[model samples]
Target: MAEEELKIEEGGKKGKLMIIIIAAVVIIAGGAAAFFFLGGSDDDMADVQAVEGQAGAAPSASTGSAKSGTALYVAMPRPFVLNVPGAGRDRLVEIKVQLMVRGSDSEELAKSHIPLIEGTLLQVFSSSNADDLVTEAGKIALREQSLRDVQAKMQEIAGADVVEEVLFTGFVMQ
Candidate 1:
């Protein structure tokens, strides 16, 4: 009987040890899977940089245009608020903008000239009619005009098209 009890105890111990080993392996595998799934990628890093108005690096001098370097977005400090003339009355409008640029140099240039750029954008936005702003085509036209005016101003100041695109991050009219 003593020998049989000892053998049973040994078997139980071995079984418990096997279960513990399997559980440990499963836990380790789960942890590794989570780490891989949640890992950061290059595109995520680029988006973070764009949000912070910083680009990876400067492109070569020969690549003088906005398309030649890494794309980044510089957000304006404040939303533009104005009144637009409507058919019946003036409507209040608010527009938030971000400027897309290429390269670190263009990002820095845009950030430094925020006030001028804001003024130019405000002028362009305020010129829109409330009826026109309500339409998709009108919004596209406004965006294009804003881009042109901003690029022209930046070109005159920085001697290059520092702003590539004018993005309307937010728009509200009432």
Candidate 2:
């Protein structure tokens, strides 16, 4: 009878150990899943950069002169960092934005509004979160908003149609 009790005790102990191991594995797996599915971190930045192509390669647009003017090339710097709650504190990133401005000379228009454009972009990007800058659709919306902001700022600063289209040269989430 003592031997039998010992056997049963051993079995019970083994069973408990097995349950503990299974529970540990499940917890580990659950943490991994949460880490992957939750998204928004340094890892997500890779996905963002991959989707965006080379920086500062904006296509030239025709600048209808008072008579006939040629288009010009312009390169603008995007916001540096976008702070978001999901990616730990504030995450820092560097971006370059390409733009095609239509005017007597695209270069001149782009140049004149560079400061205003930069400031507006910095303001907009500073306020944005990772969610706001995620996905192609989100980027498109951001571009449209940027165009409006730049054009409005140009009208205020240079009193002209300084920007035509806002293009993303470098877009990253992290």
Q: For model 1, how does the per-residue alpha-carbon lDDT over 75-104 read when each residue is reduced to its tens digit?
A: 999899899999988999999999998888
lDDT of 1 at 153: 91
Report clashes for each candidate as comma-separated counts: 0, 1
Q: What's the C-alpha lDDT at position 150 in model 2?
A: 79
For candidate 2, write residues 36-145 as lDDT tens digits. Answer: 88867986787756543333223323322221233344787444555554454555556678777543445666776677778888777666666556667767777788
lDDT of 1 at 148: 98
Alpha carbon deviation, residue 148, candidate 1 (Å): 1.5
Please state the error at residue 26 of candidate 1 in Å.
3.8
RMSD of each: 6.3, 15.6
lDDT of all predictions, in order shown?
0.88, 0.66
On TM-score, the leading prediction is: 1
Which predicted model would earn the best lDDT? Answer: 1
